[model samples]
Target: MADMQKALRARILGAGIVPRVIWGRKVPQGTALPYLQLFAVSDPRPGHLKGYNGGRTTRVQADCKAESYAEAKAMSDALVPLLAAPATVDGIKFGHTKAEGPQDLGEDTAAGFVHRMSLDLLVWHSSV
Candidate 1:
């Protein structure tokens, strides 16, 4: 298990994604452990309308852990540039999750952590 974790971390770091490995916590029944989460913002190109990835991707999160901050930052940096150009992907908005509290906020709250990232990228990319 340790070796496998190391290998996965290496791959993620090599890929240049903002990798964050958080310990798993217990959840309700049927819940899985060690769920890894990933997020990425994307821009929608003109051609994407015909495909499944229609609009600009604001955020993409998956159920998995990343190795470190370098890896996760790398992924975010790689994606930041692409968003300014043009492309389509299947990603969620910053606050698309069902979680309450910090995850969910009212309009006046001014985008929280997740939304801030998404909105900032969107604004930057849109300006370009």
Candidate 2:
């Protein structure tokens, strides 16, 4: 099966909506504001019954981080509809994404107290 997490990361970055979308939680030093951190909360094969992807459900946490709360929230606001739209990538046919956030995670003081808006996504997809 195609790697859904990688595909989602590529798609988001390719959208050019944000300056950067890192594949993991940890951001590198000296990165700019209004960036994204992508994390896979879970990736489970829901069933063996056949289709494009075998009915996989990918739970992901996509956090928008910035120097201020508004910037973080704005970045995430721009992403919600895009992620929720239906599409296909790298043999992974995506269905609508169910999101549970833009939840304020306050700030990460360790990371310069960057304000974070977190988007938890439940994605339905299949790898054809």
Candidate 3:
């Protein structure tokens, strides 16, 4: 099977809402504006009673961080429609992507402080 986490991260970048994306890590100081930080919202491999299907479902949170709230929300808004379209990235085929909760987080005052907007995602994928 294709690497699910990597594929998901790649997909977000490939979506082109923002080219700069970091997966499961802290962004360094002075990184570019309007980047995305991705984190798992649910276990990548949950217990499935029906043995292994060729595909897996994973949930992730994609955060849009920018110096301004408008920029952050705009980047996130761009992603909402893009996620709904199915596409293949890397070695993985995205069967579906659904987004939830733009959960307006106003501003964060730590680490790489910025106005942040986050979306919870349900991703369905398989190795192609």
| Per-candidate TM-score against the hidden true structure | 0.25, 0.84, 0.82
Estimate, for each residue in 1-128, the C-alpha lDDT of model 1 and write its tens digit: 22323333343444444334322243234332222333333334434455543322232333331233343343444444433443212221221122111121112222222221111323211111
Q: What would you estimate as the lDDT of candidate 3?
A: 0.79
Poorly placed runs, candidate 3 (over 4 Å): 44-50, 110-113
Backbone collision tally, model 3: 0
Error of 3 at 85 (Å): 0.7
- State the displacement of the C-alpha of residue 15, model 1, in Å, after optimal TM-score superposition: 11
lDDT of 2 by residue, 1-128 (tens): 33887778777877887888887757787788888998888887654456343667778888888888888888888888888898988777788998887789966575578788999989887776
Alpha-carbon shift of residue 84 in model 1 (angstroms) = 1.1
lDDT of 2 at 3: 81
Query: Which candidate gets the maximum TM-score versus the true structure?
Result: 2
Q: What is the TM-score (0 to 1) of candidate 1?
A: 0.25
Q: Is candidate 1 or candidate 2 better by lDDT?
A: 2
Candidate 3 structure quality by residue, lDDT tens digits, 21-86? 887767777787778998876755545698767777778888898888889989989887887888
* Winning model by lDDT: 2
